[model samples]
Target: MKKLSVIIVNYNVCHFLEQALTSLAKAAKHVDVEVFVVDNNSVDGSVEMVNEKFPWVKLIANKHNQGFSKANNQAIRESNAEYILLLNPDTVVEEDTLSKCCQFMDEHPDAGGLGVKMLDGKGKFLPESKRGLPSPWVAFYKIFGFAKLFPKSRKFGRYHLGFLSPDEINPIDVLSGAYMMLRSSVLDKIGLLDEDYFMYGEDIDLSYRILKSGHKNYYYPETRIIHYKGESTKRTSINYVFIFYKAMIIFAQKHFSTKNAGIFAVLINTAIYLRAGMALMTGFVQQTWLFFTDAFVMYAGMYVLVNFWERHIKSDSDFYPPEYLHYIVPVYVLVWGLTVFMYGGYKPLAKFYHILAGIVIGTFVIAAFSNFFDAYRFSKGIIVFGGMLSILALLLVRAVVQFIQHGNVKIGDGRKKRVAIIGSYEESKRIDELLKDTHYKLNVLGYITSNKNDVTQKGYLGYLEELEKLVQLYRLDEIIFCSKDVPAHRIIEWMTRVDNRAVDFKIVPDESNFIIGSNSSNKRGDFYSLNIELNILS
Candidate 1:
């Protein structure tokens, strides 16, 4: 029998799954292991990816979207191994991670399940690495905002067990499902993950059951993994809020007493509404902040232009009505702001050209609309001058702000992302070939290879050990690691050791076409694949 069986539940996150399998391939090398990929009817070619890139994985391609619990249970039933790891598709495990975890479980015979320290894509510690059960009081504290306000307080912040040091091996009430590994024998004794709780609460339910059975659930931090959170489900979405909270409600009903469960349910329901409201409000603010800034700049510029036109061109201080300056110009500014949004000016670091084009179009529309009403009518000269001034104001704001934030004005889309590859000569060539399959234009700075020979080092930049120096020298925006030549631990070591959040790190699995990584924990891991195209890439 295999020593370990790693089961991953994948939805539509094909790129993330490819990266996870790549990492898992290296991790499983030291231990006898089998792999299973449960695809929940993903429409993004996840099934095809497993077939083509990771044929070794036991693929259970469902016809419909099975919930996380059900899909993992399906794989658990088929897996013939001593240990079963329920791993998320959007994770990167180090080469020694599996061996270390297995060894820890072996030494601690009382341990039923185990979880390691997890970092998000940006190398930030994830609080879910250790958690306390949400009893009614814990739920009350968390829902009432006490947990967030006092995260390290043992009195209020028990949900995530914030009082416990994250670097220590502590007994936690829950193990995150993202990287939960358990003994197959223990699972058989305790029963499989409760299908009653769909996605969010299954890990807690299983953890509680393992504890109830007199086995310890440990938080092991000897090895770590990178979980690119929310690849399958956007945590900020209203749907996510509902699903996650509802799953909590299910856990309450199942585990707690009737009265406690009732209280917990009420709290979770309240949290659902509260979080849903926050999600909507946050989305609205984030989407429209740029619009608001642009609108204010346009209004301020119009004020100056109108004063100039009234004093110089009209030659009469009271020629234009007070309403024209007070109401009409504001209305025109609103129109300009809406038009800018329609022209996709709210995209990150929007170009000055888009802003200018939007203002010009809005000016024409407002001038034509004003002819219908006498009170709204103003000097055509003022409107034209206001439009010109608004364009200049908006353009200046974007250029200066973008330059301050990104070190470039981004006035055009001509600047391609600069990239460097680290691998053997042959693997580096494969990476270049795979990149050619995508439409993205990258300013590749060549590869850093271990081979110093003059024959194979065709595009050599430096050695693998000097990655930090090379990145600084070339000012690279992205790094792609080839799994065929570089081990997963070395890749992860470089990713965390460099402490460069500005550079995105990706991995190209051996014989695979895609390279995947996330620069920030908030952003999803994206990739460029040769065999398929994703909507995000478009």
Candidate 2:
């Protein structure tokens, strides 16, 4: 009989799945383990790669995605192994991982499920390796930031067992599904993973059931594995946030005492809405600030440059009337600002080319309107000169705004804030190479690897788990993520984890033709593109 059956539910993450299978090959070397990969209709040729390379793996190719719980249950029903491991496809296991789990299970008869210390693509430890039942109090503490502020305190850190050392073996309330190993006996007693949970909270439900069925869930951290977490879903997407919190509500409704469950449901929903509100508020403030700053710069540019051209360049021209400043100048400023706004100029990171184009369009529109009147027709040169000066003024204001806000300027390399890129090795390297000619207020410190064996010796900063440490060590001011490698959901989780830190977070979309603020489709041609979005949390 096989000692263990490892089940991995794979989606569109073909690269990560392939790497995981390679690591699993080493893990099963000394242990009698059968691997099952349940493909969820991935269009990325994941099925073909698995069939070609890892033919020994039991492939359960589903025409449609069966989700996390259902997929694991499908493999569990077919396997004859004494232990079943619900492993994530985006993970790398140590050679001894399977053996250690088997040994731990053999020694602990009362333990129904177990989990190991898991590290992220970066070699830093993931705290979710061991978690407590998210009761109402624990949820409250976590949502309010008390958990992170006082992780070691028993009162505040109940959710993640922050009082316990991650290396120590202990009875934990919850084992993360990423590397959860369950005894067959426990499954017989508690039944399969709850099919109701399509994705999130199923692990917690299973763990709670194990404890209820007279078995303890243990955190055996003697062995460590790397879990490239959040591959199945984009962590930063609004959909992810909604589903995650909604899962908590479902869990609470199922397990908590009636009175407490209702309270927890309310608290969780409130948190969800509060978070959404905060995000919207942040975006609004950022856009409003940029809009006003650009307007002020445009007004100043028209006032100074037009007068200089009239007095110095064309000395015969009468000095421009003061009424132009009050009536005509504001009209130009209003038109320019509105056009720029429509062209996507007031984004988290304003694009220079978009701003320039908007100003040009506004200038032409204003010039055409002035042609209707003979008196205003003569003032066309002023508008032309003002537009030129506005471009320069906008650039200067942007530089000044960046310097005042972040203590960094694009021209002065020494004054610019240091930054690091986090994503797949190739993607990070590509961005680093592309950013060579362009100038910004951030200095590319180097790249951090999001997966194993994907980094140059000098370029390696660390992994995602060690992001905060890397930020502190290098004194980095910003971190850019390649959206293709690190999903939005993972990015959101990372941002939440590093809350209160003074660092900007940005994403580079997968499409090579992506641009920050170009409205027309024609603007996204072969030109190089990059956008450094200001972190809303920051």
Candidate 3:
């Protein structure tokens, strides 16, 4: 029998799944590790990717979107290995991670399952590397924001066990499903992950059951993986809030006493509404802040224009009625705001001409919209003068905002990214050629390597040892590593050593067209490649 069986449940994240499989194939060379890609009906051609690039992997293509737990269980039932590992598709395990996990589990018979110290895409430590079981009080602290208020407080921040050191190997209450390793024997006794959970709480439920079965879960920090997700779920969505809290309630009712379960349910339900309200508020604020800001600025400009026109053009301090400010001017601003929005004025990198066109269309719309209402009608001359003033006001607002944000009043400079590659001459040339056909406007700053023969090649900045300094000197925006030439550990080390947040790191698998990386822990994984049968490239 194999020493370990690795199971990954993939949804529509095809590129991420491919990266994970490539890393796993490398990591499994010394160990008897069998990998299973349980694709949950991904229409993004994820199954085809595994079949084409990684024929050694056992593929389980589901007919529909099976939840994370059931899909993992499907693989678990088929594997005959001593250890079973449930891994996420959007992760890259270091070369030694798999071997280290097997060695640790073999040495610690009391450990039912173990999780590694996880880093985000940018090499920051993920707090979920070790988690405390979410009891009612723990859930309360996390749900109401007390955990964030006192992240290190033992009493309040027990949700993540902030008091425990992430580097130390301590017994932990829960294991993250992203990199959970379990002994096959213990799973046989305690049973598979509860299918009651579609996504969120299965890890906690299994951790609790394992403890109840008298085995321990551990935090192994000797090796780490890039989870890329910081987390996979969109926790800010109301649907996620409801589903996650609902899973918590399920755990409570399944494990707690009837009375305790009732209390836990109440707390979770209350938290659901609170979190949902916050989600709505956050979404509203994020989506409309620019709209509201521009609308207010637009209205203020109209107000100033009306005053100027009344005093100078009409020769009357109060030439227009109260409807001019309350009704007519507001209607005018409203039409302009809608039209400007429709013209893509709110988008980043929208040109000055874009806003000008929007204003023109808006003025025409106001003229037509007012003609049907006699109280708001005016001569074409007056309307044209007001329209001209609106154009100046709107352009000034856009320019000032752009200048403050980008430090340039150029409005929309669509700057090309400064990028570099680390690989052999042939691989670098292949990558450069592929990027030419794509929309990524990048100035490839040449390749970086320690090989002396390629030192004289075009775009050779310097040796790999001088990468950080080279990035600083050249103001490099991104670095792409060809996995065929650079090891995963080296890639991770350089990613950590390079402290420039302005610089992003991407990896192009050997001979693979897609370039994958996540800019930060808070951001989702990114992909750049030709648009194929896959649903989306980014």
Candidate 4:
């Protein structure tokens, strides 16, 4: 038995980290393995939890957030094991997942790294776990709507294939970082992951390097792991888009020819700017009416109302100086615009309260400095009052616009499609729970069970034979067959029986144990059901 060192890098993902460790503990029971958890300055009590619950595992706690590559390298350098598994903190392993992966690698001498099938938390196959290395042309095609135009064509939609058979092991150019099992020798030859990448694309870069060194990367679907993907950074405030693009630039610079690298660099930069432009445009259009209203209110109130009132009604008073008000209002508006721009306040669709708070802080700072320089000549109270009023007016206009647009529809309105699940009570209940927890847009109309053991307390409309009657009665938009208790073929037959009807259909993908390839074709007919046959494998 070859010893395996499992290295999991943690960065404030305590909940997922604990589940991963627990899963690994169960999986490693029959294998010789050492777990190394490199904590990247996680303030979420992950270090303390690991220390308390998994004391036997070696823990390297870092003082700062040393990213994925550096943290994994730290563990890899410290271990003497023949194989290294770079596992994510958001993944759980089956009891035999590691052992099977190790066995496959041991048998395949030319393999540098092996990746297993990764299922999402909902048990759906994640296609990116197995993929081809993205070339510049492929990137362009994917980005420019070519892939969506011809989804089934290999020339266009070759990147994402979900329906591949899960029983076969195949070679691939790139493997996902979620559950990459690397040979220790390959790491020694290619060196550790490029630290230039703080997080994303390091996996692909390393896999490409291994392939360049005459070693193959394998996607072994026989072994599987549950990856709660993106659980760590999904809600983080960090700019991952910027980070990923930066990594791509670093990779291109390191590996590609000078000319090619420069072209890709320009292309990626242009793409980023274009996207930013789109975001700005979207914001502009969304706020155009409101912006105009607020501007008109401010300018008209100051120039027309104030100037007219001060000039005609109180002409003899110094308190109503027309020239002073004219210069002061324009200067104030200019200063406010500059301050907002400098503080990144114009970033359209910025909804965070912190950003608004920053604008307030910027306004106050400007007002304080301007007042101090004037030697109390300008009224500090007036500046503060004016700034507050401006911000309040802007925010109020935005609030009214948002209310008008978003408030038109009620919460839980039928705009989101209503789905009716038909299957055993247990399976339907489980699906309902998942839908409820994830806030999935589907509405469950309850289950239809045939077996006495499948009777559940959650809810039940009828039996499996009553699917047609229920569909007509509930006016369901979609039917999801949970194939846990009943055979999938039977459900398919049932669907065929009602194929001519207007109802849309989908399956739970629990039974049949079939991983549908990306190129699988589905045909529906009066006497036949959803027939899916895999035709291509890449």
Candidate 5:
């Protein structure tokens, strides 16, 4: 048995850390492993909890947050294991995950790094875990939205498809950092993660370095891990977008050609500006409304809400200070409203880190200006602290409201969508296990066999002929057809039968042409004709 050292870096995500450790503890029962947790000065009592609950694991508590790369490096340096697993604190592992990974690496001596399939907390497979290295063309196409037009194009979407198959072990250019299993030999040859990356892009940098050193990066889909992902940064006031962009710049400077780097920089700046512009517009509208309400209504509506809260909870009357009632609250709201608009806060689907970063940057700007102008007669520390506190509270309140409105707000819901996959038994079983282990937003109702009874022994809902009745009976929302062993016409027929019904129909793109043309959008013309132009051929 090989000794595997799992290095987990924590930054204010105690709950996620606990779950990860619990999973690791269960996994450790079947393998020889040592877990080392590098705490990046989390104020969330992560260190204390770990010390009390998991004393068997080694814990290194730092004074301040040193980012992911540095913390993992700290653990790697201290550990004396043959394999270093850079595991995220937000991930959970199955009992045999580490053992299987180790065995795979041992068998493939040329592999520098091995990454298993990573499912999000919802059980949905994360595409990032299997990706090709960033090329100038791929980067440009993706940034420009051209890739979206031809998502199936191999040349255009090579990076995302590098790990499409769940059964086959394949060579990949880059593996996700969430659960990367690095060989000590490769680390010795190529070196540890690039510390310049404060948060993002470090894994890509390291994986590329390993490849450059003539070692292969393998995506082993035989094993699986569940990554809760972004819990801490999503909940905090960190400037993720800036930090990520800074890391991207570092990566571009190191690896990309001057021309490529220039293009990347331009694209990144454009994205930032576009985001900032939207945020500014939204903030302007919101501030205008606030100003009118504050000026005309004498803040009556605001007082009503506050009074309601106070009446219900008598002790929380100090929630909104009367001092903020004059002009302070309005000014704060106006600045951040504009700041958030400028930073792309209105794009709810944007990365949480980016949004949080916007908040942090906005708060800093307000604090800095107030300090310089001597606007308020208060200590700089108190003013800055209070502003941060207020921003956090406001953001939290907004998040709660949004959650209530959406009804999709579950901290650890991991809601799995019940799905009945129509494919071969072998393939379906593999897909079934993959889906079961994933933290994606899907649940496998079970696998349904084809007309041939290939999966009769494996237990299925029914044959393909009875799929419609099963769909109606089970009330399935989605149907996925794996096309490798199944006929395309059968899938089309099945889709046609389910067409216009409440269920969403999707097919696994296996044909080369279909894969190449996956993301292409069709349009209406004077006389409709098929357009077959490849977007990435440009």
Candidate 6:
């Protein structure tokens, strides 16, 4: 029997899998390891790649995607190693990752399972590298954002055990399945990961069982690996929300005492349904806020202006008749609103120019209608005044909303976002031009590159190694990667490194294209779209 058996469940991530296997090869140099690649019906030639590149690996090509727990169990049943590791394919281990884990397990006979300090792609330590059990109270803290608000406090942050430093070794209640190193002895006693869990909860279930069976689950931070998480399911998807929350519910029902189980089930169900409702509502609001904002502002401003004109300027003629208010105002508002919507008014972050163009076009259409119709001819001046007033009204409304939501109106006024570019000279230059062309709300500080060409290095702040310092010196709010120059792995690595720096990271993959008249713009600036981290607590 080998000293360690590394089991990897892979699906469609050939590039990432190759890198992981390459790292595993390096890590296996000092240890007697048997590697198993369980390809879950991947059609990306993953099986062929494994066969050709890593012939030593035991390949289990599933006819269907049997999911995480079941697939890993298949490999576990076949392996006879003293120690078993369930490693995700989207991770790259350091050379000593296996050796160090093996050494730690060898010395600690009581450790049933162990997890190392996991880093994100950009080198930021993942909190799940070590976590407290997701008990009801802990889950509450996580669901309500108490964990984030009071990360260092044990009371509020028990979910990820944010009270503990990533580098500190501790006994944890649950280890992330992304990298769980378990003893064969413990597996023999506790059996395999519960297949009842399709994907998400098996890790927690297994960890809880280990503890119940009287084995300490140690979190050793001596070794580190980069996990490019969310390859299987994006955290933002409805599927993720349902499955992740369901997993928690399943765990609670399976383990909680009978007395507490009923209450736990109620709480978990309420949390899940409430979350789903909130997500639906949020999506609806995001899609319609612009329309509501534009319509309300335009109509309100037009009402005030038209009434002012009626009372003072055109007191005798009744040019802005109350009857016209019924027909004319709604039509006017609708035309303008529809035009704005057509020009991307529904986008989360709308371009000011789009609003202006929509208003102008709508006003012209109204004026043309007035010229043709005798009834509307008298109200042309009022319509023009109202249209002009609407521009100011729209700006004011957006500014107010921005101030209320983000505590600042600079983002609304297009004066915010201190940005830095990461790419070769030409790529960075192209991105800079794109940002400028799109009239994005960004302040490009400079470029960060390792290329020695004087053209690319002309405006270079520093090499990628000096990212932290550069960000500090320039007070960068976002970093946009030139996807042609930076690989996905490097982008993720950069994100992890600066995860806590109060900065947003974006990527403009490949070439650039523009759709000026789209119903809604999907981008924030020149880079990829911005992600909204829904605060479940609020």
When 1 and 6 are scored with lDDT, the better candidate is 1
Which whole-number lDDT from 0 to 100 does residue 306 have in model 3? 75
Superposition error at 56 for model 4 (Å):
2.4
- For residues 1-538, could you state the per-residue lDDT of candidate 5 as single tens digits? 2478999998886655765787688678767889999999999789998998899999999998998899999988888888989988766566678888888888999999999877543245567778877676777666566666776677777657632565578898898888899999789988888888888899989999999999999989876765655654641122554566567677888999999888777776665565556656766776465334323332343345446655564556675557755666456555655665667655533344544665577667767777765545334443444445544544554455456643454322333446787777776766666554433456678777776545466568888888878888887766767655554335444654654345644444332111110110110001001123222210
lDDT of 2 by residue, 152-206 (tens): 8999998999999997999999999988999998899889999888999999999
**What is the TM-score (0 to 1) of candidate 3?**
0.94
lDDT for position 29 in model 5: 77
- Local accuracy by lDDT, each model: 0.84, 0.77, 0.85, 0.66, 0.66, 0.76
Candidate 4: where is the Cα deviation over 4 Å? 158-168, 235-238, 277-538
lDDT of 6 by residue, 1-538 (tens): 8999999998886655766787688679989999999989999778997898789889999999998999999999999899999998867676788989999999988899999887654356778887887777777777778899999998998888888888788899899898999999889998998888887989999999999999999999877776766664555556777898888878888998876766666767777887888888988897787678778778888778777887889785465558677777878898988877777655555757877888888889888877887756766678788778877777677777778765677533434578888898888887777667554556888898856553344777778877888888888877777656765446555666764446765555445332110011111111132222221110
- Judge candidate 6 against the unseen true structure and give its global Cα lDDT, from 0 to 1: 0.76
What lDDT score is found at residue 248 in candidate 6?
Answer: 80
Clashes of each: 0, 7, 0, 5, 26, 4
Candidate 2: lDDT of 179?
89
- Rank by lDDT, descending? 3, 1, 2, 6, 4, 5
lDDT of 5 at 31: 71
The most accurate candidate by TM-score is 3
Candidate 1 lDDT at 273 equals: 95
Residue 474, candidate 2: C-alpha displacement in angstroms: 13
**Over the full model, what C-alpha lDDT does candidate 3 score relative to the true structure?**
0.85
Which pairs of residues collide in candidate 6?
121-493, 122-492, 122-493, 122-494
TM-score of each: 0.90, 0.70, 0.94, 0.57, 0.55, 0.71
Please list all clashing residue pairs in model 2, or write none if there are none.
122-463, 234-489, 235-488, 235-489, 235-490, 236-488, 236-489
Q: Write down the TM-score for model 2.
A: 0.70
Tens digit of lDDT per residue, candidate 4, span 382-471? Answer: 556566666765566556645564442232122334566677666676666655644334566677676645544557766667677777
